[model samples]
Target chain A: MTALTLHAPILLVALPLLGAFATPLVGKLGKGARNTLIGLIVLAVAGLAAMLAIDVFGSGGIPTVYELGGGTFTFPLSGGQVPVRILFEVDGMSAFMGLITALIALTGAFFSFSYWKERSGGNLYFSLFLMLIAGVFGMVLTGDMFNFFVFLEITSIAAASMVGFRVWLKQSQEAGFKVMAMYTLSGLFVLLAIGLLYGQYGHLNIAVLARSIQGSLTDMVALGLLLTGLAMKAGAVPMHMWAPDAYGESPAPMSAVLVVNSQASLYGLFRILFTLFGASISTGTVGWILIVLALLTIFVGVTMALIQSDLKRLVAFGAVSQIGYMLLGVGVGMAVIATRPEYGLVAMQGGIFHMINDAACVGLLFFASGVVIRAAGTRDLNQMGGLGHRMKWTSIFFAIGAVALAGVPPFNGFASKFLIYEAAFKLNPFLAVLAVLSSIMLLAVFVKAFQAAFLGPRSNTSAHVSDPSLGMMLPMAALVLVVIVFGLFPGFFVDHIVTPAAKALWLGRDAYINAVLGG
Target chain B: MNIGNLPFIVAALLVVLGLYTFLFKRNLIKLVIGITLIETGVNLFLVTLGYRTGGISPIYTFAPEAQQMVLPTPQALTLTSIVIGLATTALLLSFAVFVHRHYGTLDVRKVKELKG
Candidate 1:
């Protein structure tokens, strides 16, 4: 027991991974038994994560670094440096992500209990869900670049497959194809960049590579490739075309999982920009390039969302726009680092804070859309009217989600966006003005969503549209409550959690190496 | 152990050719071929990074008194990378089969049901 508890972090990953393999065998026990077994395991994992988060952050903050393979340092390079072989560093940021991931997975698994169809390959769904959890957890925990890429592949492949789980539908298959193509291609670019870094410095660990490699042309090339690859995964504009189709095609529970997954990519983007490259490398054209991308991403994402008629696609596109907001915050931080590095801290804090808020709010929005879709049997706005009359709980939840998404005060979105707006304005007034424009547009758009789906007169088949099962409504209700609670009390999330994270990011090179490789 | 040898140049040329195939190939299989070529190029680069003048393999059993040992880390990483490439190639090919089954076509432009 003592030995098992000592390796708790590793067990967090190995548990789901082993569950993914063991699920098939467990499924053979009996019908409907697989999901129950997987749920029990994941619930335990979630509980473990919550406990770990509490332990890590109970005092100020705890940074636990583990050296893999017997904890003995093994030098794998000619440079005589201790090569990091499968290192897992658990800090506040990872602990936070771990908590959210486990919570969402637990809620999602609980929700999926009644959601999966007997004929819908339920066993496979459970298997993939476990694998997805493993991948996300690994992504947050792993310190080595190669392992990060491997986890990225795992998450992407599982997601693409799940996106097209309904293979009979041509659109699902097409969405799957497009997603697979983009994700794999982006992964190839990331691999090339990793190779570049490895060639320059004979190391694959992010911490060691950052220390050994400096701001050379090779570093720039590597950064560009890595940024482009990660941007594609983050669904930044131009590379974002695959997202709506993929999200729209996936099951609602799966879509909720995907919302967290996309946010996970944003986490990766943040880690790479602030954590991997540090402040010095983050300045100059790199910062400006991200700024341009963020500006366009917000403008393009919101505008595109405004024009969408399909409910799910509209929410998916709204996600793209929201990603713009986070990117904007990060870009502003990058731009500020060289001049007034203090402002960079605020910008990064706001950006990282928004990442958490956006995940919760947008995740709820997608979950609500899923409920509406399942109830209405159609995703088109023209067909969904007067649902508020019958599906009272859903209507209330959807409204809460929409309000939060639009950055309304006293809601979670408003708190994060407030900080983001302040940071952007402090850096560049022009950026603040543009962000305000996008926020106003976001408000108008979600208002349209509320009006069209809830407030309007009953369409022809509106009477038939009923609320989803209690299982589905419950998870979304919890998320909505969280949104409200976080909004009302933003300090708990921002000050204790996000501020330290952003400050850790702001320490520039020292923090970067310390976070990944430890002091 | 010449600084600029023909094998190195040939390896570089092979990589370029592979990239060209990736960019210009219309068939899905050929694109996979291009990716494989790119992986080979990367692996070659790793091996080349380890290459030292007159240095032999890092195997201690064959050359116990060897003063120069070619970097063994890159060789191990390249081996892992080669395995990853194999897995990717296999997954890509299997996806191609599925694509063929559904679309009945492999022409990149023809798979256009997902266009805007």
Candidate 2:
């Protein structure tokens, strides 16, 4: 147990990476061997993530730091003034994000098992999938800025390839190109920011930089680049032009994984805001900036979703909107952080809790939609009627996902959004009103989709539609179960998991810095 | 203008030019070139960050004692960025090829099949 805990952080990232490369070689054996190998790798990753989360959360939010190249874990490296060796820092927040990634990756892998049965290049597909997962894990766990950029690029390349994996489809190619271009542009923005910071501080270690940051004009410039780049990746409005294309065009299971990838970038954004530049910047200005972006994202995402005739695109827009809720929640928290307002902690908890809830809700929706698209042979909602007649299990799963995502009561979405709304109301009633209106609009949008695709008279196109095999159904069912369980026990989860994760960001900065640099 | 800051000025100009080409040019291949240009600018900036006017290479094995050495980290960072840039550019160009094959044109304006 000690050994596993000691190595779990690195193992969480390295195992999937190694498995990705080993997949093609294992593919030479047989499909059964390949599937089993991928399944085992995902399961092992989930187990490690779970163990690490338990360790971090149980330790009362002290981060677990692992040094590479077998040196002492403390910073200032024996005789050096600045820490140069690479390290992995797993705090409550990182562990929380890891658990979310593991859950979605596990389900996405399982769902892809049957989804990819008829598809060629299954080996390559799983390989890229594993690479994407590894990249996300690394992004959330790495303690260095350059390492984060490298992981960001890895996710970008793997994800873009997967988006265009259907080389035969013209739309897929177009989406792939646009997404890759945007991802590359954003990544360069990040690299340039890292360069600026390194030129000033002569160190790439995040904790060291955070300790040394003085918020000069150069620092603010770097901040602007980091913010714009990560927000673009996270699908914030005005910079979110590529999201619908990437999400709507990719394979269904890949869409769910892509949502998690965006959230990983979102994680990076928060890390920068709270931990790295926490004390240096004017929190109120930056917090209000996030709030404004959140409002725009929510309004635009829902309204656009309402008009989308393509079922996946509608869900994709909905996914983008959910990013707004998280931003609003965390933005409220950040706005009030300096004052230490009572509601600030609550708001942070809401935002952090919403992340896992959104993952499950969105993942279920995408998986269910994948099944629908597969059965009906079309993505057009108008052309996909009466699927509920035959696809009984999928209909139930889709309904659960839709209701949960729309923030309906007694589902996970409402539980988290309730916290956000209450806190936002306390902060400013106007913000709460806008959030509620958007939630209502989101509900209406999903309702229209549900009616158009599943609740109508049988069309000729859906005559052959039926429930997918247990393989795919199980993953969706698992997510449905998560939605219900999280909804029913929101307080339990908030106290145990979400609070620690939130506090790690809201109030754990000193511990984080000290863990690396020592007191 | 200060001579020492010239590299910085050139890097910023390169980035601006790349953005101009990326935003203004219609050809998909040209867009790829634009991206590469931006990448080159960033790489140059990273390399320049570590340069010291009279410092020797960072290799300590054969160096004269008690002399200044340019920072090795930024150079290392530049090399990694270049490799990553190559991969990104290769991927972008391949996607362009596929797009041209399917759409029969490389014009960005022509690839409107995905928009609302």
Candidate 3:
């Protein structure tokens, strides 16, 4: 491999880190120039990440390991044997997230041009945006547990700052603080878990630790902390109270990207479960607990969304519910993997596919809602009415996103949700029933949102609103295309992308362990 | 009752105390302090993990006279955690200062303009 190709994983992270710090200097070029630079930077990163992803996915879909700071040795122990080292391990799943993050982040940056054009602290906005991207990439790709924690902190800190971007708004600051508190506590819990593992094995590298994990009481305790903390980050119910606050309070574009951030935590959970603890832990019990959490998350998010009148809050709840489909699919997969391997693989495929679909559909919805808020200057559904007449394209985008998210036919949501519902039924018929009913509730919830926010006669407050500018409409249009393409060709994605990703999680454990250990 | 477990027990207690204060406290400042305490506790546990019965300094460059060395990895982990703890603590504190500047109070209950 060429040096550039050999270093794709590190470049994926470092390029963004460089851009994050360097953007302030670039921002001196003025708003229009600054925005163009930021857009170009994100777009470039997206292309590079997509290239790396396709390369890895093309190469027989195996785990690709990159030892960080240029070395192949795992760790230099006192006996001259290597136990562990800092590394970036990229597989189908990591590539999947990197691609999704890049896509959504690029969209978020493009949309921000129109969304935050006149806002102050635009320099800080670009810096944090890049840093958030870098942090998330690091989190998903890192091979070591401690590096994951460090990256998690970076992502949360950047996300909290972005959430508090509207510092003039009191609730924005509150949301920022709330997110920060949750992130800090979660980081510590994760760190403590890492400590337990390290104390037992003297290695923090996931592959080494996974090889050595005994699943003892200490392991169970560490697993408990990891599960709880990662679940909280994923916004699973019971501790999901913080999700709406943070997701709803952020600007629309930031909210779009935040969807992927939530998914990254779920990704971490899956990685540790299937790779780190796989074959070591009792998969049956872990899967059942996840299933329980998934059901609660699905029900609670839908029920909560039903009562929300604020447009952003409604979609935030919808986002939370979408996470259930993913967890339900993967949870069922894990639950049954030890018994029925085929069903488990299919379940995981469904969940993994759902992650990308959820990111796109939710991102489109958030951007559309942002468009409505921007044009009509309100997020309250009660106050927003009949913008469909003036904002034609925006309304169309919103309708497409709403239908797609609700699992209507010919939409990507239906495709993945179908896989999940079918696989879940194989596990147990009741899960399928609940999954179907919950999705129907999601449809009802968004239909209400559509009726309240986009349907009625134009209210007095929105009388002057019209179609948003091209800069805003373009991103929405791009998402509309994504929704359509994915919907139309779900089978293609399922075979090429989704199945390989699930395989990487379920079947690639040994390959992953060997990549670091064998070297 | 053995003294070997004392540091670990103390670390666990610190963590529990921090979680209690973090979850139950009303004041934002107190909540931030709680997070710092938990981080410190975690750092302590990490350092404790590296402790060997008769270990000397892990620095091999000087070739210390003592042979049995405590694990150096946890100490490295602890140092990284401490650095990260500093960052999170600083970020949270700044946010707290911003909260006070915005709302004129440190009470979290009073800061709920975003609640459902």
Candidate 4:
């Protein structure tokens, strides 16, 4: 491998982190310059991440593990299973998540120039935005459990500030506070779990610790804590009370990245489940717990969305429910892996694939809602009507996002949800039925929203409404392309990306251990 | 089962109590205190786990009297957690101050604006 490819793993994280700190300095140049700089930084990171992903996906599915600050001289004395320095392990799953995160951050940054240009705290906004993005990359890329905890805290702090950015608004501040409490409390639980593992195993490296864990009572309790904490962070019910508000309160660009933030927690959940404990976990019982929670998250998330009149709040609830499909798919896979490995693999692929697909679909929806909120200068669906007459391009964008989010045919959501249904059907008929039903309800929910916001007589006060600037339209169009392309080529995506991602988690234990141990 | 485990049990209860207050308390200040409590408890748990009876500090001193040293990694971890805990508490308390300034109340229920 060339040095650039060899170094892409660390560059993927450090570049954004350095850019985060550099943003305030850059902001002094000009708002336009600052936005352009942040966008370029994200684009660079995305390019590096994509390169790393292509190399990994093309390298016979072998993961690229980079040890930070470790040359032969620095750690030549190290001979144990646990590597002492911080490490970035980019398997198919991590690479995939990183790629999507950079993509969302890129679009979010692209859309931010227009949204945040005249707004206050432009410097603080870009700095915090970059920090949030960097935190996600750190969270997804790290190999040490303690490093994960630190990055989790980093992300939550940035997220809390971003959520409450509009402190003049009572709801925004309150949402920030509520999310802070939940995220901090949840974060403590993660730290406690990390401590428990460290106290027992005397190592922080995940692969090393996983190899040594014996599934004792302490391990069981640690797993329980990790599951609850990460699940809560992922917005799984009944701990999902913070999600809708956090999403609803944040500005549009932040909300787009926030989608991926929650997905990072979900990625952590899956990583811990199938990688750290896959070799020794009692899959049936643990998987059952996840499944039950998944069911609750889905049903309640959709029902809640159906009742919401606030445009952003409605989309937020819908985002929560989409997380359930991912959980259910993977949870089902986990439940049956001990018996039917083949079906489990298929289900796992569907679940992992849905992460990226959900990022695209929900991301598009959130961005479009931001556009509508901008043109109309209000977020209430009741205050909106006949936007199509004024904002033709944005209405079309919303229509595309709406149908794709509802899992209609020729959209990305359908392909993954279809795989989820078919694979989950082989495991249990009711789960599949429930998946289909919730999807239908999702369709109904968005259809009602579209009708409320776009299809009626144009509001007399909304002579001001017009199509969004090129900033917003371009991102939505980009997502529309993603949805259409991925939808049409589901088989190819499954074969190339999703399967490797599933295997990285499903069959990662031994290879991960051997790599960390330098065997 | 032994005297050594007493601090561990107390630490666990302290965590539970902290979470209870953080989740159930009406006052925002109490919620902040709750996080501090959990941080203290977790730090105690880490320190306790790392302690070795009749052992000295793990510092790199050349004192002839030193024989055995306690495990230092958990101590380092706890210190890092404590620092992070301090930063979060500062940020959260600042957020609470802003909320109170804007809404004219410190009660969480009173500040509920963006409801689902």
TM-score of model 3 relative to the true fold?
Answer: 0.96
Best by DockQ: 2
Worst lDDT run of 10 residues, candidate 3 chain A, spans A74-83
Cα lDDT for residue A227, candidate 3: 92
lDDT of 4 by residue, A311-396 (tens): 99999999999899899989988998888888888888888888899888888888888888877778888888888788888777
**DockQ scores for all predicted structures:** 0.35, 0.89, 0.77, 0.70
Q: Model 2 chain A, poorest ten-residue lDDT window?
A: A72-81
Q: Indicate whether candidate 2 or candidate 4 has the larger DockQ.
A: 2
Off by over 4 Å in 1: A1-6, A59-62, A73-81, A279-282, A508-519, B1-26, B51-63
Candidate no. 4 TM-score: 0.97
Of the candidates shown, which would achieve the greatest lDDT relative to the real structure?
2
- Write model 1 residue lDDT over A1-519, tens digit each, in one string: 244434667878888989988887987896467777877788778877876666656645545555678556432223445554677766667777787788678777776776665346777888888888888888887778877887887888788878876656666766776686677777767776787787777788777876776878988888888898888888888889988887777877777677677777777776777667774474756777888889888988888888788888888888888888888888888887888776777777777788777777777887788777777778888777888888888888888888888888989888988888988888788998998898889888888887788877776667887777887777887788789888999988887777766665556446446544445
Model 3: how far residue A27 lies from native, Å: 1.5
**For candidate 4 chain B, which ten residues in a row score worst on lDDT?**
B59-68
Model 3 agreement with the true structure over A1-519: per-residue lDDT tens digits: 466666888887888888899888988988777777777778878887887788878887767778776664532223335445588888888888888898898888888888788778888988888899999999999999999998988888888888986678877888888998998888899999999998888888888888788989999999999999999999999888889998899888888777788899999999999999998889999999999999999989998998998899999999999898899999999999889987888889889998988999999999999888887677888877888877778888888888888889898888988889999999899999998998899889988888877788767776788887898888888888988999999989888878778888989888787766663
Candidate 2 stretches with Cα past 4 Å from truth are A73-81, B1-3
A295: Cα error in model 1, Å: 1.1
By lDDT: ranked, best first: 2, 3, 4, 1
Backbone clash pairs for candidate 3 read: A74-A84
Best by TM-score: 2
